[model samples]
Target: MKSGMPAPDGIQPARRATIREVADAAGVSRSTASRALTGRGYVAPPVRDRVREIARGLGYVPDATARHLRQQASQSIGVLVSDLSNPFYAGLAAGISQQARKRQYTMMLADDGGSPEVEVEAAEAFVALRVAGVIVTPVSAEVSTYLARQQIPVVEVDRQFSVGVCDAVVVDNENAARRVIHQLLDLGHRRIALVIDEMHWTTGRDRLAGYRGAFAAAGVPLDDSLVVTAGWDVDAARIEAHKLLSRAEPPTAIFAANNVLAEAVWRAAAELNMPIPERLSLVSFDDVSWMSLVRPGVTAVAQDPVALGEAAISQLFERIQSPHAPVRTVLLSATVAARGSTAPPPA
Candidate 1:
C-alpha cells in the first residue's frame, strides 16, 4: 500500500474522473454537466462556469468512444505514408501531425514502405478504429476505393492513383521538371541523361514529360539512349549512373528524377573522378539536405513537403464537412534552388 508500490494483482488502476463524478462534485445534474462541458445546450451562465471549473479541477475528460458512437464522428485522423525513412515523407507526416493536433484531433500514423498491400491493410485498420478521415501518400487506387466502400473520407498527397475518383494534393511535377531542364539546356547542354525510378507514377511520368517538353521547345532532339531507368534504390541508381557515364559518348549533363537518384548520381560522379559542372553537370527534381551542404551545392527543384501535408489535411477537413461535394485536386508549386551543380557543358 506504499505510495511507490505496485497495485495488488486483483486491484484495478484508478481511472480519470467521469461526467457523473464531475456532476456530483459540482452539485449539478449529469445532463447539465454534459451540456456545460460540450457547449451544446443552454445552461445558466453561473452554473455552467461553476461546473466547468470543477470538471477541470477534477481532471475530467469525456469518453471519446461514447461520444463518437453518438455523433458518428471520431476525433482522430489516420495518416499513411509510402516511406517514413525518406525526408519528404517525414516532413509531410510532421505537418499533418501539427495541424491535426491544432484541430484537437489525434493522428494515427502508418508507414507502408510504398507497398499496395500494406497501404490497404493500414486503411482497414483505420476503418476499424473509426477514424474521422485518412490522409495518405497512396501507392494505388485500390486503397481509396476500399476506404470509400467503408464510408471513409481520404485525401491523397504527393501523387495520385485515383485522379478523378478521390481528393488529392499534389505538385505540378511537369512544370518544375520543365523549368530545371530548360535551365540546363539554356546553359548549352544537349546530351543530358535523365535518370528515373519509374514512369508508372504520375510524378515520374509528369517529370519525364517536362524533360522532353524542354528539349522539344528548344528544338533539341532527345537521345533515347541517354534516358536511364534506374530502380528506386540509391545503389541501383548509382550503378545506372556509372554505366551511363562510362559510355563511349557519355552525356555532358545528368538530370536525376528524385532525391534518391540525385544522391546516386552525385556519388557515381565522385567515384569516377568527374567533377560536378566541369566534367559532368548535374540537377535533381527534388532537393535534400546534403544537396545544400556539399562543397559544390547541387542545383535542385525544391517542394515544400510540410506544406503539402498541411494542405492535404485542410482539404480532408473540408471534405469531411461536405462529404457529398465534388472531389477536387489541389496543385502546389515547387521552386528551383540553383546551386553550383549546374553550368554549361565542359569545353
Candidate 2:
C-alpha cells in the first residue's frame, strides 16, 4: 500500500518498494544506491552489483518519474521538421526513428508545414514535454534565438544554426551546387539560369554561392537576371519559369535548386515547345523517386537523406550522453547523377 492510501477491499496489500528499501536491502546508503542504479558519479563495481541484484529481487523498477523530477529532464526526444509531405524529409524521419529505436529512446515528431509560427509552436511544445534533447531543421534563423533560450540540447539538421549556439549536421550545399553548374557548363551551355527558393535559409544561400563560384571559375560573368527565386512548389516554379521564358532572351540551361522546382521547370519547357538537352538543358539539386520516370531523366545532385537523418540522431544521442562535450558539425557528401536531361546547348 502507498504511504497515505488505503488498500481496497478486494485488492491485495502488495506495496511498491522505494529506493530506500532497495538501499536497505543492498546494505548501502540511499545516495550510493542511486549512483549505482543511475551509473552516475562514483560507486564501487561490487556495490553497484549488489544494488542491482537487490533491486531485481525486490521487483523494484527505478521510478523514472522521480528521477526525472530530481534531474528535471525527461528521457524523450523531440524532432521538428519543415514539411512531412516532402519525400526527403519523410525518409529522414524514418532514419531518425530507426536510430532512436536502436538506442531504446522514443521520439516526438512535429511538422511546421513551412510556417515560422508553426516552427516556434513546435519548439514550445517540446519544451513543455521536457524532452531530453531536440532535433530540428528550422524554417529560418529566428528559431535559433527562440530555442537557445530554453536551455536544452538542440541539434540542427540539414541547416546551419547560430554560431557557437548549437550543433549541426548539413550537406555541402555550395559544393553540390557548384557541381551541378559545372555539369551544365560542360554541356556547352553559357546562358544558364538557376531557379531557387529564398536565400534566407543556409541551403539556398550556400547553393547560390556555389553557383556563382562555378561561373567565376569558368570565366563566365554572373547574370543576376537569370537567377529566379520562387517558393518550394512546382506550380510556383512553373509560374516563375513562364515569366523568364517569355522574356526576349531566355536561358539555354536551367538548374533547379530542388525536386519540386525541377519538375515545374520541366513542365514549363514542355509547354514552351523547348526540347530538353537539345534546345535547353536541365539539372536539379535533389533526386526524387519519379526523377527517372520523367521523359528526360533529370540530372541531379543526390544526397542520402537516410544517412543524414541517421547521423543527426546519432549526434543528438552523443550530446545527451555528454552534455558538456564540444559542439560537432557533420557535413554529408553529395554526388551528381548524370542523366539524359543535360547536353550541349543548341548552336
Local distance difference test, per candidate?
A: 0.92, 0.86
Writing each residue's lDDT as its tens digit, candidate 1 over 1-347 gives: 57977658535527778999999999999999999999999999999999999998988888999989989889999999988999989999999999999999999999998899999999999999999999998888899989888989999899888888889999999999999999989999989989999888899899999999999999999888888899888998899999999999999999999899999999999999999888899999878898999968999999989999999999999999999999999999899999999878988
| lDDT for each residue of candidate 2 in 290-341, tens digit (9 for 90 to 100) | 7889878888999788888999988988988888899888889899888898
Clashing residue pairs in candidate 1 are none
Q: Which ranges in model 2 have alpha carbons more than 4 Å from their true place?
A: 1-67
Could you tell me the lDDT of residue 327 within candidate 1? Answer: 95
| Clash number for candidate 1 | 0
For candidate 1, the TM-score is 0.93
Q: Top model by TM-score, which number? A: 1
Model 2 poorest 10 in a row by lDDT:
4-13
